[model samples]
Target: MASKLISGGLFAIAFLGCLVNAQLDTNQTAQNIHDPQPQTPATQSQNTQSKSHPDTQNRRSSCVVEQQNKIQCGAPGTSATVCNALNCCFDGTMCYYGKYVTLHCTKDAQMIVIVSKDATIPNLDLESVGLLSKTGNCSPVATTSAFAIYQFPVTECGTVMSEEDGVLTYENRMFSQYEVELGPRGAITRDSFFDLSIQCRYTGSTAEALLLEMNILPSPYPAVGFGILNVELRLANGQCHLKGCAEEDVAYSSYYRDSEYPITKELQDNVYVEVRMLGRTDPNLVLTLGHCWATSKSNPLSRPQWDLLINGCPYREDRYQTKLLNVGSKLMFPSHYRRFAFQMFTFVSTGAADPSKGNQVTQTADTVNPTYEKVYIHCNVAVCQPSTQYNCEPRCFRKRRDIGESKTFTSRQEDRTVSSQEIQFVALSQSV
Candidate 1:
């Protein structure tokens, strides 16, 4: 009986042990399904690198900021995320200003007023304000969520200029200082308007600064004969005043403002030339342009030449296309300057196959070996004392004998020949 009881107890113990083993196996399987596999050393390194890769790429690429020149855009200790939300620049440690509403003067003698989109003026229409350009165009050049930029010439936009104590100030009074109602429309208060003022103080005289702004380099004339008979030849644009001196002929485009020699021009474009005498102050002395011609080479005597002016007049064939502008007669200039303009042309090849075609060459894609033409212009200038016998004025259609018969013009005294720098003519289809 004792043996049988012992055997039953052993069977029960075995059953319990089997049950515990099954429960352990089930728990292990569940853990394996829910948890990830353990990473190796290399796998862990690769995973870490992948997680950090996007942070480097997501950073702003052009966040260049100088430590000394940084303008604060946020309060101290501002978080990077918050600074970025403000559209301001952040340098990992601090936030700095980006773009804001401002007014400044440009080096080109112009006023630039930028109004940020964030700027607010109560009860005012920004576009319909009284601000305007020289031609009364008040439209902004560009508008974006960031800012609206308005440009105005210094002499325009209803700007008032005043000079005092060697300082020149240009002011745009958008709002009246004395009267609030006279301010720009929709202004609720005197401080609710926009205005701009810029002052230019020169270390030298104001005239020097003005000349520099105008890009007029006045060079002294070299003495030539008994009296100073120096002449200057300048190339100008169409905006140049017809009767003004070189100072008033400021180049509005950079193409004509280049001081480099051998100015380039397009074929058939009008080329304005100004010839002025310097150094002589005699009121009676008058300037006379005897002849003007162009040649392919630097030497005035080179072959393959063209005549523009002959015997104090435009060539007969190009009379309509060439014009001699009267200068120094108006109060704009002293009586020592003259101007002329002619259509730019290139000399056609004399060796063309057909003479009847008149040697007119046109640019085409099939043409081989395109070349630029170098042209040099020469002018014969004379400064003479006018008397009752000879006034030294140009007479276009008068007979040649009549000029030669004048006793005062017998000896060509104070005659100085001047030539312009080389000018290159490019084909109409080619880029300069």
Candidate 2:
């Protein structure tokens, strides 16, 4: 009876242990199926990020990288709005920092910080600052047309240049001759005879004149838009070699680059190039604070074009008028002495009477100054020069008056030496 009882107890104990094991397994299975735990935010973000960037397992490692400055990575094609929100860039794989580019300010004091389009720097926030430019793409402009050496241009409306042997030239000639001189101190000076008016004046003619029509005068010259009134190569010293030059001849020089144009003057001096809009009462002028591009037309693939930093911000040349400033000046480009130069265009609001506003707009259009296409350009062209073999000095091999043989056979005189003081200018005419 004792043996039987012990056997029974052992069997009961084994049965109870089996029941406990089965219950534990059933509870674990139910927990897994019905009582599911919520996923973490980190895990969800990781999974979403993994979809875009396969190598990146989560957001912590790639999307929000901790760099020196809060750099948001992005691609060139990504829109500016989306790039700003996440403080991240769309560098192919959603927000990723690529590289950093320094934006130098031309001002001595307040500077700017701008990022490139390569999804590195955050969209520049200048709203708090008193800056005019908005956050925009900082990509390099594509080359439309580019050439080397210099040549005289053909029958363009104003001025057109074609490549020639040694120099680039204009088809028609003007009273002004442009001379660009490189000073010993790396300062560049360009001299031009600026004709400030549309009408020709009578400046007493000499006997050597063949054309008698040269002397003419109009009392109140017919109103015309501003021609290329003045062009100065803005140098380190805002000094004009020409006496009685405009006050803005040397306004300011800048190395600073903003989203639009980096500030150059300490006090934000307004250098105005005024144009006359027949209907408008206020002054029609372009504000100049020269800002040149560091990237030049050194490569065929990278020539300059109408961009944000240029004088005419929205340079579409549509109904809206825009005028160009910072031409031929250091304010327009990095070096004033590139083999290639700025081919510029600007349209200024005529400040014209808005016909849509039901105002009687009296527009007197002139042939000399039509609607603005490309009013002017600041170019670094090859200076025209005489060949080495050419001889200008009057010589009979320094003849001794033909051995005193009563010589009226004279060597006609010709001026060979050119001076820096005399100003030179050229007008370029063009087509579509």
User: Best lDDT goes to which candidate?
Assistant: 1
* Segments in model 2 whose C-alpha atoms lie over 4 Å from true places: 1-82, 86-88, 97-412, 416-432
Candidate 2 Cα lDDT to native = 0.20
Top-TM-score structure, candidate number: 1
Q: Write the per-residue lDDT of candidate 1 for residues 197-311, one digit (tens) a residue.
A: 2222222322111101000010111112224577877776534455654533443122244443334354345677777787766776677788788766777787666777876
Please report the TM-score between candidate 1 and the true structure: 0.40
Instruction: Score every model by TM-score.
Output: 0.40, 0.14
369-417, model 2: which lDDT tens digit per residue?
A: 1112211222211111123432211122224553233222222222111
CA lDDT, candidate 1, residue 70: 49
Cα lDDT listed for each candidate: 0.42, 0.20
